[model samples]
Target: MTSASPTRAPGPFSRFEWLVAGRYLRARRRDAFISVISALTMIGIALGVATLIVVMSVMNGFRDELLGKILGLNGHFTGFPIEEVFHDYEAVRDRLEGVDGVIAATAFVEGQALVTSQYASSGVNIRGMSIGDIEKLPLLYSSVLYGGWDDWDNLEGVAIGSRLAGQLGLGIGDPITIVTPNGPQTPFGSTPQIRSYPVNAIFDVGMVEFDSLFVYMPIRAAQVYFRLYEDRLRDGVAQPDLMASDEEIDAAYERVYTATAVEVFVADPDATARMQLPLEQATGRPMVFTDWKQRNQTFFSALQVERVVMFTILSMIVLVAAFNIISSLVMLVKDKSSDIAVLRTMGATRSSIMRIFCITGTAIGFIGTIAGFVLGVVLALNAEAIRAWVSNTLGIALFPPEVFLLSSLPSRVDPVEVSVVLVMALALSFLATLYPAWRAAQYDPVEALRYE
Candidate 1:
């Protein structure tokens, strides 16, 4: 009886197919050159991935750190009055506060001024915000090193940045004199508005711009300092004496509770680019809205461009490694022609032969990619320690604070970015295998066996 034609197989693919694929990956002593090339290919890919990981992580850290500081001091979107001051600022602030994305909305006044202490004098940006607003900002509140936000609320003093205080040789409780550009208009021309407030706190925002030039005062004090009181006086508000009591200062500040701009903090600053029109429409006033991205576009744009350029340049190293994989596989196919002929004689199909080499080449790339991912993550996590070690050992500073603005090297790996890198590596490697694997598959079994 003719037994039922031998069952072809139970599974989709034969076990023998994988067994032969695995065997092709091992090199005999005679094929030692191929083995060496394969090893070099793996090493090159690993190094490229590791370097890319370190660089991208550092850039991500830099962007995040700078963004945190910038957003800390500034707003996601700021609405400026078309006129000199926002007369209906409370209405505007209330409207903005009711917006969906706005977490907090506050009135702010910022202007250039000269601050003087007993020891020295420096130009600074006099910024005014309410005590309640200051307390709402953890970045500002937690950065206070010497005193509390309560001091600013009590109208007892103002908070100056750390570098400003250092330059003026002043500290908390020391008196700081401010001279505003818009001074009282007197018959003897306009004299600079001068006011002295005790330094109630010192803040270190870790940014040269902020630390060296910004001084924070209560909204009323800032109004008085910036001559906003002049507008109040015009509106039938009584002018107070220089040694005005706290009650008088409160009344004066309340009368002129207008802001030059309303700073709106959002849940996501990155999305602020698209919110300008919406914000302007919501404010229901003829106001101009400026987002933080627009304010620092050049800086952030440069970083993004550099990151793209760096990624492209670094990916070339992996491409070169892929070339090595091509060469090794090509040589391997040439050397194993006799084996191909024998396997074909043993009933192996042409597609099976191609899959064997493809598997071999992909295994090399897959293994190398895994090794690279591990090495990259380790290096990125310990980048600071590595920087310190290299600096100490080499007697050199890799990134100087004076030049880089940051005190130390920083790195932060994003998992999504890492996954993209890994995928790129594997794709390049698998693509590199196509030509060589196809070449192996094209061998004429008749001619190959004729020579054998």
Candidate 2:
């Protein structure tokens, strides 16, 4: 049996240490300034943590909203003809759909056109899609503010964006003329096709760009208006007159068709690159394939860089609070020097003295961090509502749809990020206590009491 060392220290964080730590933290007339400093330190920490959480959550929300709107409307991947226009799109669509992980394939004819209403005119990109494929994009069909998908195909009319309709002073059933340079080639030059189609539906996607610059029409009408597919008599055959009989109109339906592009959707958009090879094999043609990430690389890259920068800048708040902790602990140690000496003379170990100050300082940080965490979560969860309330009271558009892509503010609180912040704050607080606690533990009882 080994003999116990006579100078063995008491168990760590003993009851005595906690009692002394509590006593020192309590407000006293002599230590009023120290208490004030400690209070300010805790407040600084709370404010810093709360601000970081709110900013990070808002940035995350912005990124997610933008990504979802862009990708939701434009699919995960798209391919266009490199050599020739996408011919036999039906068969190509089927083949592309057969690829592993491919969710759906939609063939679309997109062309730049100038849309004119009686009031105004705007340059718009017109996308033509079949009803079956149109329904696949829930972001479009589901957002129809007025009018709907009913009789959408039979009407041969068009769907215009809400903003476009508003700007042109047009409503549902109003005729909107479209002029495009993609018409038939004539002796003079490429003849511009000018035709008017009634607006049958209106959609508001809550995104300024999309809501203001897009028009949707049935696939057949788009093919006809854009001259993508046409039926005519053989060369040298007599062309039918404008008032051709119904029989002639029926016969004209027989013609070859082509599509400008095909958009593919996959199960997981983030892994879109993995589906490239399979899509190429399925197409078996020289096609230009582009994914969402590649198309928006610069935009999303900027967002990521901004997030990191914000985190670094806001972390300084917590750092400043940690510095305050050091200042406050040092002051507390000075004010309690005599008490520390008395405790030392009464059989209290140096470690106990150190722990007293450590506990006092750590307590402030722990409580502050918890308070900040709670405040952050509450604010993040209700960020949009708060924005609305403030904006209403101030009579300002906080997040205007035209300026910001999203109509309303958005926030998403990530648990992992919150956890990291708490740990970092606690670590800084603990570190700040070390030197002050060490100084308190080094008190000399004989020298300290000699002056008394």
Candidate 3:
């Protein structure tokens, strides 16, 4: 007697199902149109993901560079006396420096003045600070391209920015004229104080606005020029004489120095809010304080909003590519309906047929996402060089430092953000396949083959 043939079973997603999926994905000349559509879908997804990564990276770069430069030059926060004058600035400065988490505190005096050289004239902001304070700020101290620090404290001496020097055609040891209306008042009215100061140093801070508009002078000089001072002697007003003997100094102290405000530097700028109260208590005075974020809120808020809008708008590219995936799968399901029906009649499970189509679509998504991730990372790593190359080869100004406020284009890729983009792309692609795969699995074998 002949033994009964053992029944065969094609388990869900078995090699048989994978084989069928691979065959369908292979581009046949007869289904060339569907093959082209699938290819375009993959290309679309790749381009979309790459663009998202690049744009996000650029935005992050811009934010970080700007914040560093801003906080580097301006410190994290500042305070101006609410009473209009910080009496005994030396004591106040010392107290602020002694506080925990405080990097340094400077008695900062600032005033607006008109500067003129043989070449040109411009309105500039003069910062009056001691040489000791300048040493604590790396942005200014490390950026001195010419001249020495000793000359900064010399009588009628100053430090100017590189761009300012260029504009005024001034160099080290060259004198620049400053005119401030807030100077000592005369019999008629307020008279502009005009003084010529020799340039001791020139600095380029890699920022346009600051480099062009800032002038540094001795704090004593600033206080004198801005008319911010207090007389100690009850008789005629007299400026302090540091060389006076102890008996002469005791007889009548000429004057005491003062400041417009105190600038505080902290170890952690992000902790500005938490440090504010402590800093105030340390100052031992009533004061009004301002932080960097508070000062540049509008500018930073706009940046954040723009980043979100850009992401939302660019994500539509991936969404459209996902729609392309759905379209290609739908056409594929129609073309393979006969094969699906034949398999069903031969005892193939419905789940196996569905998995076949799902695999085909998801493979495209996975490969496309990987291609995009690699391409995006490479582009971000070389964004600045690429920008320079493109600008040079095209013979055009791509990013002018004066307008863009930076010497070069910046890009920084975050690994977490990139992973998110990849996962999102793959998820969209997988979702695009479900309806078409389900339709293919639901085909009735009897009806599908009756007409064939």
Q: What's the best-to-worst order under TM-score?
A: 2, 3, 1
Candidate 1, 365: how far from true, in Å? 0.7
TM-score (C-alpha) between model 3 and the true structure: 0.90
RMSD to the hidden true structure, all candidates:
4.7, 3.6, 4.3
Ranking by lDDT: 2, 3, 1
Clashing residue pairs in candidate 3 (N, C-alpha, C atoms within 3 angstroms): none
Clashes of each: 0, 0, 0
Per-residue CA lDDT of model 1 for 389-452, tens digit only, reads: 9999999998876576666677899999899889999999999999998899899888987866
Candidate 2 Cα misplacement greater than 4 A, ranges = 1-11, 184-186, 230-253
Highest lDDT against the true fold, candidate: 2
lDDT of 3 by residue, 1-452 (tens): 96543332345356777788888889999999999999999899999999999999988898888887788878687888886566577788889899899998888788899999988999999999888888878888888889868756656689899999999999999999999776666899887799998899899888888789999999888888877877577476355488978777656756777788888899998898899998889878888889998999999999999999998899899889988988999999888778888899888877778888999998878877888888888998899999999999999988788888877788889888888889899999999889888888899999888888
User: Residue 117: error of model 2 in Å?
Assistant: 2.0
Alpha-carbon lDDT, every model: 0.83, 0.88, 0.86
Tens-digit per-residue lDDT, 1-452, candidate 2: 98644434356677777887888878999788889998999999998999989989999899889988897889788888887756778888889999889888999988999999889999999999988998889999799988888977777899988899999998988999999887778899998899999888999987888889999999878887877875646554566788999887666556777898899999988887688888988986778899998899999999999999999999999999999999999988888778889989888888878888999999999988888888988999999999999999999988788888787788999889999989999999999899999998998999888887
Off by over 4 Å in 3: 1-13, 234-253
* TM-score, predicted candidate 2 vs. hidden true structure: 0.91
